[model samples]
Target chain A: MAALVIAEHNNQTLNEQTAKTVTAAALVSTPVHVLVAGENCKAVAEAAAKIAGVEKVLLADNALYARMLAENMETLILSVAEKYDAILAPASTSGKNYLPRVAAKLDVPQISEILKVVSADTFERPIYAGNAIQTVQSPAGKKIITVRTTGFKAAAEGGSAVIENLAATADAGLSKFDSEALSKSERPELTSAKIVISGGRGLGSAENFKLIDKIADRLHAAVGASRAAVDAGYVPNDYQVGQTGKIVAPNLYLAVGISGAIQHLAGMKDSKVIAAINKDEESPIFQVADFGLAADLFQALPELDQELAKRGY
Target chain B: MGSDNSMKVLVPVKRVVDFNVKVRVKSDQSGIDLANVKMSMNPFDEIAVEEAVRLKEKGKVKEIVAISIGPAQAAETIRTALAMGADRGILVKTDGEVEPLVVAKILKAICEAEKPDLVFTGKQAIDDDSNQTGQMLAALLGWGQGTFAHSLELTDASAKVAREIDGGLQTVELKLPAVVTTDLRLNEPRYASLPNIMKAKKKPLEEKTPADYGVDATPRLKVLKVSEPPKRGPGIKVKSVSELLDKLKEAGAI
Candidate 1:
């Protein structure tokens, strides 16, 4: 049986993370099956079928899956689990919410956020805030895993796969859909962006995040925040990047006024290039940064923006 | 609502070095030895315990039970929870670091026996920084889960939990018998009062082992070595802010 890669997408658009998940799946097994579960998600299933190395695309479309409720998702996935050797999902919020349940129901160990598949059963993952790497061996059985998209490339297009429509299961009546307040952003998502410009408490206020915004806009980068900035109410909890928050690995990570704590470093230490701009030379962020600038961000922002513009970002 | 159906809440706590203790990770990276490390209840788990106690105080819950799977020393975390207003405590005694899935399985067995109306845990333990246990427990118990919850409210038979998502907050309404893993922002945990501390000493703390639940706490992951991250190269102090800007340009850091 092939590995099943769960596709993360709404009916209208597909999240690129789904492709990266496919890339992770390819490392473990060949002929991956992409599962797209949602109401009227045929387009997503169709698109997933085109991803390279995808052997089949499975679709489970029903009103019960409209919100991707955990209860219903677990039941639906478990019903089809018998056919797959491994089940994988991108470690997005949605995937994190449901994959563990699937792993538990199957009574199997789940390798979360696997950076590499050393063998069929052995895997490598980050522990101790990415300060240590743990090599784990899963119980030799059907595997359940969540792939961190940042560690793998997105699967390219140009494959033809069979699309199979699967049936949805009865709702478990364990949860109800409440309203959601998703922040709409014209900028790229922090996880997918090549460049990320984040601010810290030094940004001063929530209103001052706009200063980092100007620089991010010029570079077309995503905006992020330190836990201090989030705790100080400079940004919402969603913008936080730390041990307890989002993990992002981008090509270039620029930390502005952010004194890098170990917890914060755990989140973005994997970035290809790290740059810290802080007035304090002793700030811990400089320890991990490839480049450090000792300057007041208040004065540094406009100049950096002008320079980036001159370079034609 | 006054009947046994009134929710029974379970909160799990862990004792770790206080966040303020400037952790100087050992030079060899043989793993952070807490032999002299000052420890306290993990900050996020404190919020979970506080949320549970508040729900009980609000009459939204019938009882709050605090549980910790750690060395006998971890009873301190349970006592702290009791001092904060938990009804009782359970200590799943284990020595050394246990793999997360093993801990989840043990917790799952306990949950099966106790059948809590709700389960709470810190999003991740500060030491291991593995955010897998609670989600694993929820999965094992076949229960709904909400991670990184900053705010939660319980209605008659459902819970309204606001989980911090990627770009914003997602308010999930889960029926009773759900799992919630807390973050640091959940609430300001109350310090234990002297009187409450005295009373907490009297609360029941049942001790059990993973063997009692027919669960194995064996580790699947082996730490080959723990080492400090590579030392960053020496930094050059730019002559001035202008020189700094020029340096940043040269380094392509701008």
Candidate 2:
């Protein structure tokens, strides 16, 4: 049986992570099948079919699936589970939310946020806030896994796959989604951005966050916050970067006024290049930093901006 | 259904240093040791215990049994849960770090004996941040699971769990005999009162060994060394905010 990957996309467009998920799926099984669940998501499904290594695109279109609610999704995915040996999803919020339920229903262990696929049944993942690496073998009949998209390259585009419609299952009337207030920003998302500039509690107040924002805007980078910043009310909870928060692996990560806590490092330690700017040389962030600048961020922000502008970025 | 047929609820708790503790990397670069570290109940696990207690309070749950897999010191964590209204406690004594898979295997054996209707665990342990044991145990038992849950409700035969997802939230409904992992926003756990703490001392706490479950508590990953992270250079404070701005420009931080 082929590996089945759940596509992360709205009806209109597919997410980049879906392709990375396909890449991860290819490691375990042959002829990957991508499942796209959304309302009127034919365009998205068609796009998904073009990803290399995918043999089929299973489309389940229904109003109940418009929001990808776990109730309806679990039913739809479980209906098709018998035909696949493994079910994979990117370790995003959506995957983390529903994959475990699927694992439960299948009576299999769900490997969450795997960093490496050692084999079809064995995997390596970070434990204890990335302090320890664990390699585990699933003792169940089927393998259920969530892949961290950053660990693999997105599959190249342009391959034809069969797109078949799958019937939606009966809706499980569970919790009602009250509403969502998504942050609107022109900057790239923190997870997908190539460059990220984050601020820590040292920024003092929410008002001082603009300093980090200016630098981020100048570099066309996403703005992130440490848990300290979020706890201090300097930013929303979504901006928090740590073990309990968002994990990002970007090309360049710059930390300003942040004392890098171990929890915070667990989220971004995989970044390609790290830069730290803080008044305290004793801050832990400097240890991992490729470039360390010991200066008050208040004085460093304008200098960074001026330099970037001079370089025509 | 008769009261005798009610399902058991098993909750596992852990002791961690306070999240607010300003941890400093030791100069030797070895791993952070908690010998003198101020410890508290793992925040997410506290939420798990709270949810279990609430279910019992509402009469939806019959009995709440709390367990902790750690050194004898972990008894303190179990006592905290008992004070929160758990019916009994189990301490699986071990020293040092226990591999998540080994822990999961042992828990699965315990759950098999208890035959719980539901299981609750923190989404991840704060100290190691490994979010594996709950899912692994669910798999080992062939039960359903809902992870990173922020809200949950019970029905006649299934559970409705609200889980925190990236960019939004997703809700899953699963049949009973499920595992649910708690996140921070699940609830603000209540503090144990004096009487409750005293009462917890008398609550049943059974001690067991990992060997009882036929699982080896050996670690798969070995630490070659533990060292403090590197240090930052001295800070150069600018004379004024404008001067600071100028320095930022020079450093390209802006």
Candidate 3:
């Protein structure tokens, strides 16, 4: 029995999470099939077909799936559910919305945010906001899983898998999309970025965030904020990175003015290299940081900016 | 709207380790150490109960029922909800961790009997962090769902919900008899007043079992192990900004 990976995309460019999810799916079973369901998402399907682990791309291009509503996506996935023993998706906000519905309709339990696939029937996932890891064994039958994108490397792109057109489309007429107000940013997305610079309440005010922004612009890194900073209205809610917020695992994560709360640590503890700059040397963030600098960010920012500029960054 | 029209809302709450307390894995590796841990209503579920209460306060809803599925101690969580303004509560007495699917199925049976127009829950429980029950319940009832809702407005037959997504916010309109899971920005939950706490003790409370709903309470996923995540090693302090940059560059982090 093959695994079915539901691709994450915006009908234009395929999301990097899909490739990572395909890698996790391949760990469970071979002949990995990716279901690209959206309106006019041929390019996205083509991109999925090029992922290394995908064996087939099933494209369901229709108006009904354009928004990927949970009710409609559940109906569509069930139409092709027979051939798959496992259904997987990246645990994005969108995937978290729809996959549980599919699982419920199938009368199966879902394994959320799986970090590792130990075997076909067993897996490891974080619980209590990554404070503890629980290894779970799924009952024999069907497995529904959501992959934590940071856990697995993105599958490489070199193969040419065939894309098969899927004719199934569904509309439950239960909900209607109204409008969206997405934050527009020129920087890289926080979850998938190579480097990230996050500000905390110690930065003082929304206007003072420029200190973090200038460095982020120089390094071409995504900007994130501690929940305290976001709660203080220094940034929008989406900029928050912590428990109950976005989880990021970048190669280089720089914390500025952030007091590391346990909730905050839950999100970024997986970073490869962590650096923190704070006046309080005893801050908990220093515990997890590979490198720490006890200095006032107000004075340090200008010097760091000057140094980076001198180095031609 | 006729005089007989009375909108009803059902909110489900879970009792878990309080948000402020640091959770620790048990020495035996069975589960979290909860011997003396302070237990409270899951924070997200508290928001859900508050949302329902606000609806009833505005005369948009006639009744608000809070429900919980856990041990006998979970009844106290329901009392806390009642103090926050739920009209009544139903406690499904179950012993251990009930997976989201089973919880949803039990809620489905409760919905059939209660016939509430709206079901509200915390987006996810802090313990398991499985954001699945509301969507699963919505699926089992063949109704629409709005998850991670930060803002919601109700009409006689529809609900307009503003949800928080990864990149930003998205709004969706769901028809009547729907499920809504709340996010942090929905509304600040009110502290249970001392007077209300006394009144909640007098409020009607009903108890049942999972067997009453005819849903098996067995867990499908077996826990092979429980362990602490690897800890980050101690770090070195750099004296100057230039020194910090040099060390970062040495580690290929620049």
TM-score of every model versus the real structure: 0.92, 0.77, 0.98
> Where does candidate 2 chain A have its weakest 10-residue lDDT segment?
A173-182
Query: What docking tier does model 1 reach?
Result: medium
Worst 10 residues of 3 chain A by lDDT: A164-173
Q: Give the Cα error of residue B85 in candidate 3, in Å.
A: 0.4
**If both were scored by TM-score, which would come out higher, candidate 1 or candidate 2?**
1
Q: Tens digit of lDDT per residue, candidate 3, span B143-171? A: 99999998998887889999988888899
DockQ of each model against the real complex? Answer: 0.49, 0.18, 0.88
lDDT per prediction? 0.82, 0.79, 0.93
Please provide, for model 2 over B1-254, each residue's C-alpha lDDT reduced to its tens digit, 9 standing for 90 to 100. Answer: 12433757999888777776655544554456566888888889999999888888888889899999998988999999999999899999888878667778888899989988889999877766656677667755656667788688787787778776665355667677878889777777999999999999999999999998897787644433343323334445334444544554565554
Q: Any runs in candidate 2 off by more than 4 Å, and if so which?
A: A138-141, B1-10, B14-41, B50-65, B68-75, B84-87, B90-120, B126-163, B168-180, B186-196, B206-254
TM for chain B in all models? 0.94, 0.89, 0.97
Which portion of correct inter-chain contacts appears in model 3? 0.88
lDDT of 1 by residue, B168-228 (tens): 8778888768889997888999999999999999999999999999988876555555545
Q: How would you order the candidates by lDDT, starting with the best?
A: 3, 1, 2
